[model samples]
Structure formats: C-alpha cells, structure tokens
Target: MSSLLPRLHALWTKETLALLRDRHGLAALFVMPVIFILVMTMALHDAFMPGASIDVAYAVVDLDNSPQSQALVRRLDKSGSFRRIAVGQDLDAARQGIRENQYALVLGLPAKFGERLLAPAGADGQPTEPLTLLVDPTLNPALQLAFRNQTAAALGTIRADELTRRAGKLFGLPVSPAAERDWPDEIVSIAVQNQRSIRPPSSVQQNVPAWLVFAMFFVVIPIASIFIIERQEGTLQRLRAIGLPFGHILAGKLLPFFVVNQLQAVLMVLVGMFIVPMLGGEALHMPAGRSLIHWWLVAASVSLAAVAFALLVASLTRTSQQAVVVGGVGNILMGAVGGIMVPKFMMPAAMQRLAEWSPMAWGLDGFHTVMLRQGGFDAILPDLLKLLTFAALSLTAAVWLNRSSQP
Candidate 1:
C-alpha cells in the first residue's frame, strides 16, 4: 500500500506537468466552455430574460366594438406586454397576420363580448365568454403559453371591473369602491400549457445547466487525443516499464484531466453568473438554501463522469485521428441526444424518453436540481448515482482495454 501511494503520486505529478506544458490545450479546457456558454447564452439571452420590456409583437382584433371591448384593447396596450401592431375589425386578417409570422399573438374578442360580460354564469359551470388567444406557431411553445397566461391575468384583473359594472347596470346597485381592491379566490385556466418539467420560470435557468453539461462532456477530445499521442510515441511503453500497477497509471492519466475539466465547469458557471448579464442577459437566479459545496460536489461528480467517457474513447482508438473523430463526433452527438443542444422539454416525447440514457442528461439533471430547483443532496442523489454508475462502468472498460493493449 505504501509503495502504491508513491506510484500514484508520481504518476499524477507527471501527468499534471505534461498537461500544463501544452499551454494551448490547457487554455482550451477552460476557454472553450467560457466561450460557448457566454456566446450561446448571449445569443438566446433576450428569449430567456425578456426583462421588463415585452418584445413579442402582437395584434388585436376587437370584433365587439362595444365599450368593454375597446376598454380591453386599451388595457392591453397600456400593459406593454403586447404592442398594438394591427387593430382591425376583421378577424380573418388577424389570423392571416399570425400565419405570416408577423405577430406573436392575436387577441380576438368575440361578437357580443359586451353582452356576455353583462350576464351571469349559466346553468353549466363554464365560461360562455372565453377569450381566444391566437398565437403564432413559429414562436416557442413555452413562450406562447407564457403570453397566454399574462393576457389571462390581465383579463382576470379587469374581470372584477366588468362584473361591478354589470351588477350596477342589472340591479341598479353599485359595488363599494373599497371592495374592488381585493381579488376573490379563483382559478384562471387558459389553453395550450407549457412549463418546465424542471419547472423553471424562465429560459436562462434551464439553458445554463444544460450547456454546462455539454461543456463537461466536451473534454473528451483533448483527453482522448493526449492518450492517443502518448500511446503512438511509445511513451505508454516507457511508463509501463516503470512497473506501476495498471490502476495507479490509469489514475495518473485520469486525475489531471479530471481536475482540468472541473476547473472548466467552474469557469463556465462563473461566466453564467457574471458575464451573461453584462450583455443584456439575466444573471442565473439561485434557488433558496443553495450552497457552494453543493455546486462543487455535483461539478466534481460530473467531471469524473466526463473523464470516464474520455478514457473509454482513448482506450478504443488506434490513432490520434481516430481519437479525434470518435471523441469529437461522439461528444456532439451525445450532447444533442442528452438535451444539451435542444431542450428535452422542447423535443418530441419519444426523444425525451430516449434521452434518459445519456450521461450528459444525468449530469444536467443533477446540476439543474441543485442550481435551479433548490434540490439538496437527497434530491439530486438519483441523478448523481446514475452518473457515477456510468463513470464506473466506462472506467472499468477503459482499464480492461488499456491493459490488454499493453506489452
């Protein structure tokens, strides 16, 4: 055991110094992710943050030219969530506008909207007066639903006012002004739903953890390339002649790259926190009781998982070109399959189901659980275990492959 320690330590030292000597590769370990997260996040920042200003251009068709209908249009305009692009009497034109992708939403007030507002609920418990929110199919489904809810909420507010007006007209009795201030308990249900399975309120929360997982997996190229280079140069034979155990030698190769990937993860995360907002993006808001340790532990686990895959690629490849092809192409493909490139929530249901097998998916799931969902160790445990299990299996296969190839 004492002799084993020296072998591991010396190997680790040698591997670290060698990696550090390649300044470009070392920089890439940190730089590529920072570039990816920042540029990608910045590109999508507006969609994610949306901020105080509403950018979804919309048109309203007030079919009921009544006082109530006009008032609703006025209210929508003042809210700033919807800009009045084209307010027309023709509903067909409004639908056409949406079809052409000219508008994000089309607010359609039905005929007799004023009459419906003046009436009470019918025998059946249903809204006879339903607002039709015609959304552009081109817009994100999640964004479409958010627009629906925001409009619904506005309608909900004006509902009391309309109700009060109706009561005064019907009974000749006015509601007290003070009573209007408090909202009654109610459920406002709108159509065509979307929220995160992870349940984040915005896009930034989801994307940050996702790209971080992709970046973690991207370490495969550099790591596999290094291993292939060493093997081809007969350095693997030289290291073998020193008589170290296979486990110690493998640990030496894995640990330095593992640490490098961890640093990459940290740098990418910090970029999200500080750099994202400077380019008119939202900072990643934290869930309650978040700890730095939780971040580190999850990052460390994910780094190990990534390193194991790198080792697997390095073991099987016969040349540096093969390593680059397998490692680079594999990372990109896995990223797509894992919900790193396209959100799983946005993917087809079958693809979403299939994505569960990806290591990057597990890593992102664990990271998001802690970073966005305020999940503790117990909450992230299932995902973390899956990642660790994958790592162990891949590492075992890599060791077997590496030892069998050795003289």
Candidate 2:
C-alpha cells in the first residue's frame, strides 16, 4: 500500500507538472468558455428581454379628421410607445409598414368614427359597430397585449366621456360633461402606472448568467479528455506499473480541472453579478442569505456531475480526438435538451419531459430555483440528489471500465 501511495504521488506530481506546463491546454480549458459565455449571452439577450427599445414605425390613417379622432392619435403619439412615421390618408402605406414589421400596431380611424360615436344608439340601445383596432398578430404576444390593453383603455375613456356628455345634455345639467369628467386623464394615468409596474429587466440580465453557467460547466468533458490521451499514450500503464493506485491517479488528474471549473463558476457568478450590469445588463438575481446555501449546493452538484461526465467520456473513448469529438458533441446535445439553447418554457412538453435525463437540465433547474425562485436548500434538494446520483453512477462506470481496459 505504501509503495502504491508513492507511485500514485509521483504520477500525480507528473500530471500536475504537465498540465501547468501546457499553457495552450489551460487556455482552452478556461479562456474559450469565457468568450463563448459573452457571445452566446449577447446573442440570446433579445429573446428573453425584448424590452430594449424596438423602433416601431407606425402610420395613422384618420378617415375622420375630427377633433376627437385627432386627439386619439395625439394620445398614442404622446405615449412614446411608437414613432408615427406618416399621418397620411393612405391605408396602403400602413399595410406596407405592417408587412415590413416596421409597425406592430396600426390605428385606422374609420371615416365615420366621429359621426358614429356622436350618433344616437339604435332601437336596441347599442352602437351599430364597435371601434376596430388593427394590430399585427405576428408581433410579440406581450407587446400585442400591451398595445391592446392600452388602446382599449384609451378608447373606453373616450367613449365614457362621450356618454357622460350625452347624459348631461339629456338631464339638463349645467356641468360641461366632457369638462366635468376626467376619464381620459384617469385612464392614461392608470395605463402609465401599469407599464411602470411590470417593467422587465434588460436582455443581459436574462441571458448572460444562464449562458455563463452553461459555457463554464461544459469544459469538464474536454479537460477530462486529457486523461484519455494520457491513457492512450500508455502513461497510465507506466504509472500503474510503478505501483500507483487507480483512485489516486484519477483524483490527481481531475484536481486541476475541478479547481478550474470551480473558478470558472465563480467568474461567471461574479460577472453576472457585477460586470453584466456595467454592460447595460440587469443585475443577476442571486438569492440573499439563506438561499445562498441552495446556490452553493447547485454549483457543487454541477461540478461533480461535470467531473463524472469527464471521467465517463475518458473511459468510453480510446483516443484523445475521439474523446474530444464525442464529448463536445455530447455537451452541445445535452445543452440543447437541457434548456441551455432554448428556455424550458418554450420547449415542447415531450422535450421538457425528456430533459430530465440531462445533467444540464438539473443544473439549470437548480440555478433557476436559486435565481428565479429565490429558493433555499430544501427547494433544490431533489436536483442536488439527482446530480449526485448521476455523478456516482458515471464515476462507477468509469472506474469499472478503466479497470477492464487494463492489461
């Protein structure tokens, strides 16, 4: 045992020295992932936060150039939600804007909008036709909802004021119905308040931290491939022949990478917390106090899973090139399935169900619990357990395979 210990120590020392000497390998292990985090985060930012100023060019076709119709158009313009490109009498221009995605919503005041509003109700006491709002359904659903709500509220206020004036005239009241009722003022104020209350965080906030977690956690497999290369080159054989125990050798080879992975994790969190904000990204929604434990558990579990996956890849592949190709492809596939490429909410139900088999899914879920839900350790316990089980199973397979591969 003592002899084996010395051999293991020597092998570990040699592997550590080689890794430290290989600057290129270390850079690949660390630097490339950081670059990927930055790039991918930026690319995906718009999908999550779409609130960052989209230039919406809209046209208003006012068939009724009455004071009320003009006032409605003015209200839309004053809201600052859209840029009125042309206040023309051309409906074709408005349709062109819709086709070009230049305008998401088009306001077309019908030729008799003013006359219809002022006309008395028919025998049934209902207006002949309700005001029509033309909006592009192809646009973002949230934006559509916003526009619909705002326009509806605005039109409702206008209708109410008109009704109140008609009522005042019928009752012979001295109150100037439009002047006495502040419906438009109240409705507009309410709409503005609603917009402020639901303001979404920036794109960077929504994407950077998630991508950083993914990019950093994925490097484990490639780093583990180093072991496969060493094995293929008979380095493991030589070390084993010198009496090194398998466990010690595996531990030593993985130590540096484990450290690197943890550091990458830390960098990602720190950047998400601090640096992303400087880049006009929202601050990372890290849980405070008690919830920190859950996040820590999540990180530890992910790291363990990474290490296990690396060892499994090293065990399964016979050559360094094969390990790299297989591991890299596997990483991407796992990431895609696990909600790294697309959010789980956007995925099909079957795909979401299938994602349970992916370690990345577990990692991302844990992160969501910590960041999005502000969950504590208990909330992420199931994910931690799953990851640990996966790690243990993979490590066991790796150990058995490594032993079987030996002469």
Candidate 3:
C-alpha cells in the first residue's frame, strides 16, 4: 500500500507537468469556460429576474388627463416597479415602445376613465372594464403574472381614492375619513388596461449553471486526446514494464485531470461571483442558507462526474481523432439530452422526462439547488448519489473496456 501511494503520486506529477508544459492547451482548457460563463451569465441574467433590475421600462398614456389617471400614473412611478416611464398623450408612442422592447409594458387610460368610476350603477351594477395594459407576449410568464398583479393593485388603490374624492365633491363636502364608506360595495369597477406585445422566457439562473456543467464535461475532448497520445507513445507499456500497476497508473493520470476539473469549476464560480459584476454584469450571489462545506462537496461531485466521462471516452478511443469525436460530439449529445443546451422546464414532455435521468441533468440540478435555490446537502443528496453512481459506473466501464482491448 505504501509503494502504491508513492507510485501513484509520481505518475500524477508526471501527467500534471506534461499538461502544464502545453501552454496553449492549458490556456484553451481554462480560458474557454471562463469566457462562456461570463458571456452567458451576462446575456441571460436580466431574463431570470425581469424586475430585479432597477430599470424596468414601460409607458403610460394618460389620455384621461384627470386627477384619477394622474394619481394612478404617479403611484406606479413611485412604486419603483419601473425605471423609465414614457409619459405622454401619445398612444402611438406607447404602442411603439411595447413593440420595440419586449421587456416594456404600456398602460393606457381612456378619456372617460374618471366618469366611469363615479357613475355608480349604469342600468345594472356591472364592473367597469379593466385598464388598458399592453404586455409583450414573449415576456416571461412569471414576470408577466407579477406585472399584471402589481398593475391591478396599483390601479385598484387609485380607483378607490378617486371614487371617494368624487363622492365628496358631489355631496358639497371636503373628503372625510368616513369616505371609505362612500365607495359602495356594489360598484365593481377596475381600470381598463390593454394587454399587448411580449417576448420569450430567458431563464438565466438555470442556463448559466447548466452551461457551466456542460463546459466542465467538455474537458472530455482534451483529456481524451492526451490519453490517446500517451498510449500511442507507449507510455503505458513503459510504466507496466517498470512494474506500475494498471489501476495505480489510471489513478495517477485521472487524479491530475480531476484536480484540473476542480480548478476549472472554481474559476467558473469566481468569475460568476466577482468578475461578472466588475464587467458591468450582475454577479451570482451565494445563498446565505447554504454552508460552504456542502457547496464544495457538490463542486467535487461535478468534477468527478466530468472527469469520469472523459476517462471513459479516453479509454474507449484508440486514436486522437477518435477521442476528439467521442469526447467532443458525444459530450454535446449528452449535453443536449441533459438540458444544457435547452432548459428542462421549456423542453417538450418527452424530453423533460428523459432529462430526469440524464447524468448531466442531475449535476445541473444539484448546482441550481445549492447555488441559486435555498438548498443544502439534504436538498441535494439524491442528485449527489446519482452523480457518484454515474462516476463509478463510467470509470468501471472505461477500465473494463481498456482491459478487454489490450493484446
């Protein structure tokens, strides 16, 4: 056992130094994933929480020009729900804004909006039509629901105040505290807001971490190529000739790449947490509820899963060309099935079902739970077990296949 440890350590040093000497390869290995994390995180963050940003854009066309319409607009403006509001009498411009920016919502108040609130019961006590709220169809469903609900509440508040004020003016008295009783329970009136343009869901949190898992697994290509190179150079035979055990040799080779994968994982996490914000992008914040130890365990599982996948590809391929195809194209195929390329939530029913069993999908789910969701080790145990199982099976398969093919 003592000799085994020393031999493995020596082999690990050899593999690591060989990788480090190849500056261009190491640069590609580290740099590409970092670039992807920064770019994808930046591109997709706003979509995840549409209103999280201070600058939510929308327009209000107060065609009523009355105290009621003005009050509603002022309330919405103060709510900080929107950053920039284009306020004018121009319905055309409001429509244009909704069409131009998918994130933008438009509110239009009709000319007789004030009169409708005060009319009480016209024939029957029917509720007045809702306010005109134009929303982009492509907007996120959650954001759409939130925007609609918020608008409803704001408009409801303004309507009640307007009704009370109008009743006081009609009764020839200043508005009083008892004015709350003046709004008849029978009067069912809400503003008439139109619904318009919207865009697609850009679910950022799911995507960034999903692609990060993909990039980690994609180390398959380079690692597989290295494995094939060393084998072709008869390095494995020389080690065997020098009395190195096959298991220890394999362990030594993978240990360095395993560490490399962990480093890559950290690089991606650091980029997301610190560098992204410095570059004018929103940084991913760690959850207060999660312990750092649990988070590291999840990170380690991801690295092991990725390296195991690479080892399997490396062992199965006989040449560098085959390794590239197996690692590159094969990982992409796995990624597609795993919801790395597309969100599982957005996928079709069949695909979503299949993704439930995908190893990459499990890895991503683990990350999303701890990093974004309020998850700890307990929340992620099932996924961790699945990942560990996958790693064991994949490594076993690689070793078995290599042994079977040997002359």
Top candidate (lDDT): 1
lDDT of the candidates, in the order given: 0.73, 0.69, 0.72
Per-residue lDDT of candidate 3, residues 249-279 (tens digit): 7788677877887777677767777888787
lDDT string for model 1 (1-407, tens) is 44877877787787777677766566556676677677767665555433345567888788888776776676666567556788887878888888887887888888878668645567456566677888777787876887787667656666777777667768978665323333553443332222334333355666777777777776776777778877889887786777656677678877777777777766766677787887676777654455456766777788888889888998999887888789778888888899887877778999998899888888887777676666678877898789888899999999899878765
Candidates ranked by lDDT: 1, 3, 2
Worst 10 residues of 2 by lDDT: 186-195
Ranking by TM-score: 2, 1, 3
> Any runs in candidate 2 off by more than 4 Å, and if so which?
1-29, 40-55, 74-86, 92-106, 117-208, 285-290
> Weakest 10 consecutive residues, lDDT, candidate 3?
185-194
TM-score of 2: 0.76
lDDT of 1: 0.73
Stretches off by above 4 angstroms in model 1 are 1-10, 17-28, 46-54, 61-65, 78-80, 85-204, 285-290, 347-349
